[model samples]
Target: MQAEGRAPGVREVAAAAGVSRQTVSRVLNDHASIRPETRARVLAAMEELDFRPNRAARMLTTARSRTIGVLASSASSLFGPASSIDAVEDAAREVGYAVTVAHAASLEPFDLGAALDHLRAQAVEGVVVIAPQQRVQDAMAHLALTVPSVTLHGAGDAADEGVFVDQLRGARLATRHLLERGHRRIAHLAGPGDWSEARARREGFLAEMEAAGADAVVSREGDWTAASGAEIGAELVADASITAVFASNDQLALGVLHAARLAGRDVPGDLAVVGFDDIPEAAFFAPPLTTVRQEFAELGRRCVARLVALIEGGDLAFEEPVAPVLVVRESS
Candidate 1:
């Protein structure tokens, strides 16, 4: 047979490499049963000929597009969904899968259903929803998709396969750290009530304060923004009795830091401040804020792994609550 100056076909490559066409197929498909040496040989031959596998043909044969869908909230949020997206993409690529991202920013009840339906129509093998807000969780609670689905930051009843960091534990750590620093009157600058993270942190702070036999000052709700943090921080400063404050997130904590400077209160000298999320800026805050570090990337990777297992009909167990670490810095 006369071979043209084109990339070799699988059969030609297999013949050249002294392997069966089926062996080449298995190697290209990344089947684990093939011997490593055999796979190396097939891969070398294909490389020598610059042969590229036809993705369309492969998808048709396998009935899989080799893609997973990630449904998350606003992509603009650096701390949560955005971090998760990066982690999922990195982990999926490591396992030979591609990721498609869908943002459910509004997460309206109807919109949540529509988003899931849309991802399903795209032929995704599985879907992951990163729902931190209670409304988003409620929206997902009514979904009955047979396609394997997992939720991140979901409440107790959204999905059986859910992943969440221990926000309560994080709060306790932040509050306890301040208490150890000799701050008796501690207040909370909480995130919006709609968010599960914020609520969990509030509960954790309350629990730790009651356990320490210290007075629990009323919490001021912030919208997880620097402006809200500044506003609430000023209020706490005006009260004259609050000596320590725990902000739900780093952004808000930055605002609190600013408010403290404006009020001429020396951090850890006149007042102590702690925050959560331990964002990159947290380490560079004026006094290098003490905070809790939530492993956003790890959470994302685990969520995808569990969803993929469910999609593949594999028996997998849900992971227990992930722990958050307290990062000690100059702020406290």
Candidate 2:
């Protein structure tokens, strides 16, 4: 037993388990070479003694913090960013690494640099950047990062440096659904121009429209909010010639639905609408939304796998961008 009023250390646990100090350390670090039975024995010893390994002391000796840093923007309120953060945490834990997150104050280069600096000071072995905007990735490209990094939602601008859902393809799928429904004069409610996903979806909408030889009218950029969608949707429906609308996101699509109802236009009968990001509340929308779904959980797993590969100097195999699914509902 440990001395009165004192906790047992690694040395005591090693003695109790009849293993060397190095073996106990291996079990604590989850080293792959440790035998299953040996690992169990060490764990039992730890539980019996109530011994806790000090992470800082381990880092000092092993130089492995087993931490992955996340640089996030708009994570608190935004669904996509928030989901990505959660998925990343789950995946990292499965691989015996913890996550440290630093939110950027803004997309400015200085702010992003400061966030990265904060992560660096934490001794994170690698970083995953949830960059939804083109400028965020662009800004990070210029910054000097000693550790390996991966970006999300960067639209594949940096070769194999990021993991992302195929926004362009998903947008094309949404636009094509409208075209297939015989909507000739189609309108698009675009997200903000600065966002990479918005730009890709807008381009995809225009491209698909041109390919179908249909007349396409794109509204002024929106702020990815239902209010913005409602305002732009009101204008698009006013044209009377436009019979369908493709919104950049579910929130915007909800606004479009609101505008259509106020304008006395029945959805799919007067105006067919499609949206991206099949958020949880989408199916419960007034008419049930037909939208594109991005598998954020899969994207998160791939991001962690890719980043861990880079951090551990493993094979740098290229990962294909995750595909989005087109879900058809009453809205379209």
Best by lDDT: 2
Clashes of each: 0, 0
Task: Give Cα distance to truth, residue 73, candidate 2, Å.
Answer: 2.4
> How many backbone clashes are present in model 2?
0
Question: Across residues 1-332, which tens digit of lDDT does each residue of candidate 2 receive?
Answer: 66878778898999999999999988887799999999999999999988977878899988999899999975336877888899899989898788999999988999999998999999999999888877787888799989888887767555654478888899999999998888999999999898888999999999999999999999999898999999999998888899999999999999999999999999989899999989999999989999999998888888899899989998454557789999999998
Would you give me the overall lDDT of model 1? 0.80
C-alpha lDDT score of every prediction, in listed order: 0.80, 0.89
Candidate 1 lDDT by residue in tens digits, 50-82: 787876677887888777887776533657667
TM-score of 2: 0.91
Deviation of model 1 at 144, angstroms: 3.5
